[model samples]
Target: MVPIDTPTLGDRSYLAHDGSVALVVDPQRDIDRVLALADEAGVRIAHVFETHIHNDYLTGGLALAEATGAAYHVNAADEVSYARTPISDGDVVEVSPSLRVRAIATPGHTFTHLSYALESVSDDGIEAVGVFTGGSLLFGATGRPDLLGHEHTSDLVHHQFSSAHRLADELPEHTHVLPTHGFGSFCSAGSTGDTTASTIGAEKRQNPALTQDEEKWVADTLAGLDAYPAYYAHMAPGNSTGPSAPDLSTPESADKETLATRIASGEWVVDLRTRTAFAAGHVTGTLNFGVDGQFATYLGWIIPWGTPLTLLGESPEQVAEAQRELVRIGIDHLEGAATGSPQDWTDAPLGSFERAVFADLAQVRHHREVSVLDVRRTSEFDEAHISGAVNVPLHELLDRVDEVPSGEVWVHCAGGYRASIAASVLAARGVHVVAVDDSFDEGAKPSGLPIAAA
Candidate 1:
């Protein structure tokens, strides 16, 4: 077994093989890595299985199946447009003479979710070894059930409760629990303390969704759900119809004149430099989405779907890395890229923003007509924040920029990553941005700024 971890998305795909035959589960859109792993393992891929119509990232199941002549398996209930082996609850597939995988319908995150349990078959009969619990039962939490939208939240919460119990009841205590959506994934209702690997026995004892009272579990899960990226809306539909195979070829390189033309035409020009470097100097009108931060999530959230985008990075490597992140969420309309400093690329006057700490803001807030924009989530704002700060969650900033009062704007989130993103968005719109690029804890003190509950 090999676990292919995409750290940016906090998602995992697996290759389970018994000597000569292999089965892939929940693969991401980029199939090259899976293919490389299979080649190294000296096994031919025999099947590809999708847990559900993924709402977070594009799936490469159809493309991989076509490439390798493997049978692609998907839940019949999903009614996906692509041709696939329609798998249902309790369907067992024998991948090799010794390995058998059985499908378990575990719908909660989506209506068509399925979990596959791997078993070892021998003369002593089938012995279960592990299970791919895909968005149903996570390590220390259950998958959030509200991805289908507000109308289905309560109904899916009920289903999630039943599904968690079902997994705990049916699987052996020793069965290894491998999930696709818990390790820092936004699909989870809340943080799971960063746990990545566990067994059914441990989850039964530690997972709140498994141990808590059914009603209380559902209530807590529903209450803690946070807003996800806007790009998520396009993923399920794209996957349902079978997303086109990702084009991993390097994008065209844009010269200084080409980049200028694109920017003048109102296309998105993203700077993949460090936040500090971006704040020091950048091409005017370009938004800074640092390569080191959560680049894809924030970029996808703010950029309109199908908008032609071009990237400016320090090197070809940085641009390529950012491109990979962008394609994971199906943002494939990359027009081109340019690699150089602002001075090297263009003669336009460089733009910059003021970086400040919370304590510095405490002094400035009393004197100037400044507006503090809290870009954290609503829940974070409700806990404690600067008494007069306006709440505009980072994910919704592009749509609600008008709500942020004019004048010198100070933006911040729990950490500096979101604050940088918010600052860049505001800066791109010609708003004077002061990025509070430091820890929120240092700024939340009473001595630094007056604190109040939302």
Candidate 2:
């Protein structure tokens, strides 16, 4: 078994085979990665399985199955428009003489979610290998139950608790617990810790879903969830209707004037450079969503859906990487792109901002009046934050930019990523701003600044 990880989005797709034929689970929209892995392993992809219609990313299962001429397996209850080999609880698929998969009803992440348990058929008799607990059972957590909407959260969370216990009770302790979410995906209801692999025995001892009572687990899980990306609203619909392969070909190159025009016309002209490099010099009005740092998640969270987007990267590769991230979230197309330095993009004087540390913020605070903006989520801010800092999260910053008080605004997130994004938004509006480009725990807490809890 080989796990294909999408760390930025905190999800995994698995490819398991019996030396000749392979079955894939929860593939991302880019099918090329899966195809390459299969070809390198000298195996044919015979089956594609989805634990559920994903809410985080458009599934590549249908596209990959179509490309490989494989059988596509999805829940029989899903109201998808595409034709698929309908699977339900208790149904078993014999992939080869050595490999077979049994579907187990584990609806928690979604109403019709199913987990597939791999069984190895041997001369000694059939033995279970592991179960693909997509969003139902994660590393140390379970999938968040709120993605379906507030109306279903209560029932689904209860269902999530029951589903997790069911897996722990039914699967053998030695059976591997391979899950699709919890690596870093927002689908996780709590922390997944840092482990790479786990077994049912380990999960039963450590996972919140397995250790806590259903009532407490449901309450804690719901309380721990912060806002997920706005683009999530589009993922299920895109997956259900069957999305085609993304057009990853380089977008039409935009000149300086075109980029300016797009920015002026209320389009998102994003700068995909390093936050430090972006702060040094960038075209005025271009928002910074550095490709190096959770680019798609924050960008997709903030950008108005279906708005025309143009990327400004330092290279063609950067632009392409950003394009790939966008496509996974169902942002299929880019308006245009421009690669190279700010100088290459524009002859006009570029916008610039100060990139400081927590110490600098403290020093500046002592000397002059400045508005300190904390751009982390409200839950994060409430846990602890620098005293007197205005709490407008990065996702809500654009809409609430006016709420940020006038004068020099110094912004910081837990780390520096979201701070740069917030700084860019402020700088674009001609607000004097500085990005605290250092770790909060490693910098802010130790920098002798006053920390307070809400």
Candidate 3:
């Protein structure tokens, strides 16, 4: 079994083979990576599986199956527009002489979710090896049930608990547990822990769905779920209709005047650079969504859907990388891109902002009137935050910008990443902003700032 991990989205795709023929599970929009992996393994992809209609990233399943002429396997009950070899619960497919796949109905993440049990066939007998739990069962937690919508959350959580127990009871104790979400993806109900490896036996001992009662498990899981990406609203619909392969081609090059015009017209001119570099200098009215951070997730969450996007990067490679990330969330094409220093992208004195650590924020508070802004989720702010800090999550910042108290606003999150994104948005909107570029626990809690519980 070979796992293809897309860390940015905190999801993993799997490829299992019998040395010659392989089956792929939950591939991302970029099929090239999976194709390259199969090529490197010297195996022909004979099947592609969708554990569920994904809500996080566009699936590359249809495109990959078409590309490889392989049988695409989706749940029989899934309302999809494309043709696929629909598999139902208890149905088993012989992928090759030595490999077999059995579908198990494990609806929770979605109403039609299925987990595939991989078995190795031999002259001795057929033995189950691993189960691809998809969004149903994760490493330590289960997938969040609220992604479908608030109306379905309660019913889904109950199903999620039952599905997890079903996997534990039916699968062998030693059977490896493979899942597609919960690495850092918001789809997870709770922490997934640091280990990448787990088995049914281990999960039974530690997983809440296994250890806790159904009522307790449901309550805890529901309580733990926070806000997920806003772009998730578009993913399942895009996947159900069968999205085509992503267009990763380089966009048209834009000069300084073009970038200026686009920004003036309210197009999203994003800077793909470090927060420090972006704070040092960047094109006026352009927002910073450093490519090295969770660039696509935050950018997709905050930007208006279908808005023209132009990327400004220090190098062509940076812009290219951003394009790939954006496509995973179904932002397929770019309006344009510009690469080079801020001076090269703009003739006017480039826009700039102040980036400070928590220590600086602590010292600055004593001297002047500054509105402290916490850009983390509501749950995070509720647990602990700087005393007197206004809570406006980064995802909701754009729409609730006026709620932020006026004056010099000092923005922060659990880490520096979200803070920088918020700072950029506020800066672009003419709010005096200072990004707190430090860990909240290591910085704010100990930096002489009065931390208070909401």
Candidate 4:
């Protein structure tokens, strides 16, 4: 237990194991929370570092560094299109006056991923106070090695094997391990274990990801890596180009004309409103996954990762929070957001789509003879689902389209994002898909819907 020194900087963190001073690891676009915490603690941010060129959160390290006059550090192996202080194996950096960070090159999660070691000198010897393993090692698991190209999968596995052992062998027995990702993050396997931070000795003993059989472990782990979204392809190129940080706290509102322009140009419309709120009235083709729906998780699933997203909500604050939420799930490349209602877009009688509720969906399934495909994870479908629904997890849907019946297809996830992605995949195959709008959360029965025990 790191004593909850990490206050989930609004889904990220600001503190290390000991809260005397703070080390901001992988700060997302809106760093106001971190800034405020540092201010409250009456301490300056000793150092700001990126674990690697994140495909998920738009890094605020550079911006935060500029604002606070802190030194920015990344992996020495990475040559991201910006001037950054590089850190390699056994490299230590001084933060402010007395604090120091030792960089341990832990590649495999990303080409440029490095874990920062806090050099706290004691009567015994110089040892790291805490290890900030950004996207490299999680409490229950480690980062996915296949995020990059498979060309280096072998090298990554080799490095990851060595990297885990390196941390296991070297990090102090009491040194705290703080990971960038927490629960609900697919970046690391077994993230749902709820083990936030653990001692080096504890991790070495328990974490299966850290055990010795390097080659086989790496091969097996990397083999099952899932495909990233199309949006990530776009955002990564830019993230690699240089330090691109968006002011997440200050998302600007777009007018109706601007919203219409983007929508007309065929950019996907993401309505960050509740299902009931969206069903009342919404622009046609706009997908609704409310801020309450693990906002970014749904965005990560449904919206193409790097697709130029334009947020629409009841207000500006809501949209800003939505953008930050999207960043948390690695969906960068945002366009802008509609602060107020762009009634003009809805007023027009152009191409539009509506929400598909349970009643409407039931009537359609009975009336039109459609193939209801449930795209939840196989385990979830095996648990329970709508009757006669085909089971195919969103990640595996594209490969197993044969299971998708020839008739009209209506897709759904625990919510809507997975459904949207499934629908998109089916649509590309020339099969039209209707996303069920009312299935907000898993096992939810809104008014009238039936499910069979699996």
TM-score versus the correct structure, for each prediction: 0.95, 0.99, 0.98, 0.74
TM-score of candidate 1 to 2 decimals: 0.95
Which should have the higher TM-score, number 1 or number 2? 2
Ten contiguous residues minimizing lDDT sum, candidate 1: 439-448
lDDT of 4 by residue, 223-281 (tens): 55555443444445655665444545555556667777776677776777665455455
Which lDDT tens digits does candidate 2 get at residues 1-454?
9999998898999999998999999999999999999999999999999999999999888899999999999999999999999999999999999999999999889999999999999999988899999999999899999999999998899889999999999989999998999888889889998989999999999998889887788888888988998889989999899988777998999998898788889898999999999999999998999999888888988999989999999899999999999999989888999999999888789999999999999998889999999999999999999999999999998899899989999999988999999999999899999999999889987899999999
Stretches off by above 4 angstroms in model 1 are 363-369
Q: Please, what are the lDDT tens digits per residue for candidate 1 over residues 46-160?
A: 9999998998899989999999999999998887788999999999999998999999988888888999999999999998899998999898888899999899999899988
**Tens digits of lDDT, candidate 3, 374-403:** 999999999999999999999999899989
For model 4, what is the C-alpha lDDT against the true structure?
Answer: 0.65
Clashes of each: 0, 0, 0, 6
- Compare the candidates by lDDT and give the number of the best one: 2
In model 3, what is the error at residue 372, expressed in angstroms? 0.6
